[model samples]
Target: MVLSKVGKKINDYATLVMFSHTIFSLSFAVISMMLASKGSPSIHTIFWIIVAFMGARTGANAINRVIDAEIDEKNPRTFMRQLPQRMLKKKEVIVFTAVCFLVMVIAAAMLNPLCVMLSPIALFLMIIYSYTKRFTWTCHLVLGITSAAAPVGAWIAVTGEISWVALFMGAANTLWVSGFDIIYGAQDYEFDTINGIHSIPARFGIKNALCFAALFHVVTVILLVFVGILSGELGVIYYIGLGIISILFIMEHRIVSPDNLTNVKIASYGINQIISITFLIFGFVAVIVK
Candidate 1:
């Protein structure tokens, strides 16, 4: 099959950004959209929301990869990534990022005036996160806040406003994501430390960093419980899901310590995939079965 130029670009961009990971925050976005619409978002809203999400996620990842290409090249684990391997050029990535962000802008404009109005702030958050790791160990939190935008934006997209419910969900997502990031970043403890990159493990030592991760996840579960209580939208099923997710979070922390990162990828990527998917499933069921 002959691939057209655009088709090749799509393939490259997909590989460049590991587009599969879009599921992470997208699950929350979907949940927020469904809850905001009382379980049935219009197809039009759903379509545009998905488009906006894909663009934002891809654009953010591409930009991050570009910014960290040199760092990635130095780290053995990331040495083979597209940017570090030179399979994708920085200029190409910049163009792709620009195009993806434009898609987000277009989608937001289609959603509502408020969404359009807030698009720049969203973009700014995404862009600024790439720099955070350079200066702060709390870069994980920055990334979480950026990731949380998915759900919050979806809620705003659906209702054309924000609420404590969206904020709660965002906070839950923030801690959930940040906790996992601390775990994942621990895998690069040596590389980050040797290179002077600011990361939880690099700054606090891996054991204490894991402690921070555990603390963050505890807050995550609490915030989620609050979401269930405060929103009154999510019901017992979502709470049950949160309970299961809490167990998973505990397992995630237990299987990996600073000295034993053997299960780090499993805890971070494999189980994390299940966590997000579970959220999507139970979140949907909570709304549908409510």
Candidate 2:
């Protein structure tokens, strides 16, 4: 009975953090790690990278939920979330977040001195992004930066140094995330405007926001092309993944519009997941072939 209760509670926390959504960033991180290692990272490195990502993402998500609890309660679309629905207490979530961060720091320490030094900065970026919506319409970009940290940090973990290739990977991730985020934010246009929560959609309207998203995605592809070139390792397979990603991005935009955001979830979540996984697979193949 106690075990079952514990299991359920663990599941609840996972749901609260949207744990499965880790795929979105994990794929990019893994691809970056492989590139940094020239397609041959140690198992130990891989384990710690995965641990760090899980800890950072889960903690960041938990804290975001706690910080935005009241706002989420007021937003019709988010009112059913764990916090707003009383599925998780504020203190419980806060404690969980702290534990997750501790795990992240420990994982970083296990990796290298550089990763240890950078962990706190990554944590700060992740935490600060949640509050950006209250003050700036650039919140989506802030979020993209936070998400980009995953790939950049993974690259550093492997090479123990920064490189242009890593920066290109980070930039690609930043623009890709920011683009889809603009589309996702459109679903909350009404709630955000009324609540004074800044977002591209709230500030510029959905139609214009989608346009900006498309532009960002276009740059995302270009930056990815640069990443391929800069690495001097990735090849046809990587570029093929980019092509598929471009098509997926187009499909993402086609399903939603200012007048009809009913499929926003599919566009922002489902398609992005496929894109990430597709990139991860093809990137690995390219790396191995080289």
Q: For residues 71-143, could you state the per-residue lDDT of candidate 1 as single tens digits?
A: 9899999898888877778998999899999999999999999999999999999999989989999899999
TM-score, one value per model = 0.96, 0.98
Check candidate 1 and list the clashing pairs: none
lDDT of 2 by residue, 1-290 (tens): 99999998888898899987888889889999999999899999999999999999999999999999999999888899999999889998999999999999999999999999999899999899999999999999999999999999999999899999889889989989999999999999989988899999999999999999999999999999998999999989889888998899899989998889999999999899999999889988999997
> What is the Cα root-mean-square deviation between model 1 and the actual structure?
1.6
Residue 218 in model 2: shift from native, Å?
0.7
| Alpha-carbon local distance difference test for all models | 0.90, 0.93
- Where does the lowest 10-residue lDDT sum fall in candidate 1? 1-10
